[model samples]
Target: MKRSKPRLAVFKFASCDGCQLTLLDCEDELLAVAGQVDIAYFPEASRAMAPGPYDLALVEGSITTPHDAERILQVRRRARVLVTIGACATAGGIQALRNFADVAEYARAVYPRPEYLETLAWSTPVSSHVPVDLELRGCPIDKGQLLEVISAYLAGRRPNLRRTSVCTECKARGTTCLLVAGGVPCLGPVTQAGCGALCPSYDRGCYGCFGPAESPNPPALAGRLAELGRGPDEVERLFRTFNAWAEAFRGGGRPA
Candidate 1:
């Protein structure tokens, strides 16, 4: 007897949906992915709302409300394997910047009826609500890495992803060191290797869209940035951009 195709579901919470678009932007590769698994519940792709017990679930976005927190529990129960995609799902994205300030005050100032509003104080990652089997980091995750993860899942193996810093990618692409040569405040030394050192190639400093790499020395990098005439506040602002809520980057963003 042949095994049935595994059902795959993509869930969203509070996000800009850029990561979801990356999957759709796969274009030709998406056709191959379609043949491998049954896209059961991807609202971004199709309107088909297939029922639960999905083999794999790709979750995008952060938990920003009580409803989203509860929904993730249900998603966890139904999905055999849950992989969080993008910064929102893994590190709460830019929305998690609210975790630093007063959310209630912001709401009151923005909305006329703050009393009617119902939202969580903090925008938290999915892992904070449930166990995440794997996490893909980025503002909008790299498509190649996303495909590798799916292929690995189908083959019943671990994804072969590099945990090295973006500096490694820069070296591979023969891109000049923006920080050392130009004295630009770059996050290449600390950011994860996935974006292929895109910013550096354009003579711009890395913004750490892929979050922190393995054993990243962000404090050391912060010191270097300080030496480059970047004040503590400026360095903090840089670190607190896309992956602000990420654990390793969080401490790095703080004033020493």
Candidate 2:
């Protein structure tokens, strides 16, 4: 008897759907991937949905509501391996900035009737609610790396992912450091690799879209920025980007 293909499911919660889109954006590779694994459920791609005991589940988004917190538990129950994709699933994303501010004030700022909206005071990563097998980080994850993750899971091997900084990629590409060349504030030294140093290659500073590296010395980088004439407010804003809630970037001095 032929062995059955592994069932795969893609889930969404409180995200912009950009990460899920990355999977679809794979184009040529996506067709080959579809042939390898059973696309059990992907509502973003099709209206059809399948029931689980799924072999793998790719979850994207933060737990921002009481209902979302409950739903993640159900997904965890059905999934053998749960992988969180994107900054929203891994570090709580930009929406987590609400954790530092008053949610009530934010609601009033956006909505005419704040009382009608039901949302948690803070947006939090998926790991806060359920055990995650892996985390793929980015504002929108890179499709090539995403394919490697899927391939590894299907082959029952550990995914070969790097925890290094984007600066490595910059050096490999022979791109001049923006900070050294033009004194631009860059998160390249501390932001995780994956974006292939795209921004810096085009002469722009990294905006921390891939989040903090495995063990970033953010304070040291902040001091360097200060030397470049950046002030306290700029330093704080630098840390408060895509992965603001990540521990490495958060003010308390721990890995994010």
Candidate 3:
């Protein structure tokens, strides 16, 4: 008897749809990927749809509404293996900054009838509501990493994801330490490695796009940034970017 192809579904919530685009961006390898799995339901790419329960589900974005909060539970039940992709799905994305302030007030300023909007008090990741099999971090996840994750799950093995800080990637790429040499306030010391130290190579600081690295020392990094002339508020803002709501960054990146 031949083994059947695994059914894969992609879901979205409150996001810019950039993570989904990363899947489409895997143009060259996509056909081969499709050959391995049944692309069951991906509204971003195909008009066709399939009813779950799916073997694998890739969720993108955060829960920012009552509907989304409820929908994620449904998604969880249907997926045998659920992987959250991008900062929005893993750490609530940049929109999570609203968690600090009044979302209703911001909604009122932006929308004509804020009362018409059925939104939650804060944006939250999928893991906040349901159990996730894995999480892929990044503002928009790296395509290579994404492929690796899928392949690993299908092979019943752990995804080979790095847990090291961005500083390690900089060193490997032969990129100079921006903070040490240029007195630049960088989050690389605490930020996860991905994007292959892209910003640091261009003489820019890591903006913490991939969220917190393993056991990150955000406070120590903040202290160093302060020594480099960055004010406490500036240091706080750096930690409150794409992965602001991540536990490692949630305390405002300051010394506790």
The window of 10 residues in a row where model 2 has the poorest summed lDDT is 247-256
Tens-place lDDT digits, model 3, residues 1-256 = 9799999999999899999899999999999899999999999999989999999999999999999998999999999999999999999989999999999899989999888888898999989999998999998899999999888977989988999999999999899999999998888988889778889999999998999999799888887777778888888998898998998999878643
Candidate number with the higher TM-score (1 or 3): 3
> Top model by TM-score, which number?
3
> Candidates' TM-scores?
0.97, 0.97, 0.97
Clashing pairs in 1: none
**Model 1 segments beyond 4 Å from truth?**
252-256
Model 1: how far is 175 from its true place, Å? 0.5
Q: What is the C-alpha lDDT of each candidate?
A: 0.92, 0.90, 0.91
Cα lDDT tens digits, model 2, 72-107, are: 999999999999999999989989899889999999
Ranking by TM-score: 3, 1, 2
Tell me the spans in candidate 3 whose CA falls farther than 4 Å from its real position.
none
Q: Return the lDDT, model 1, position 121.
A: 97
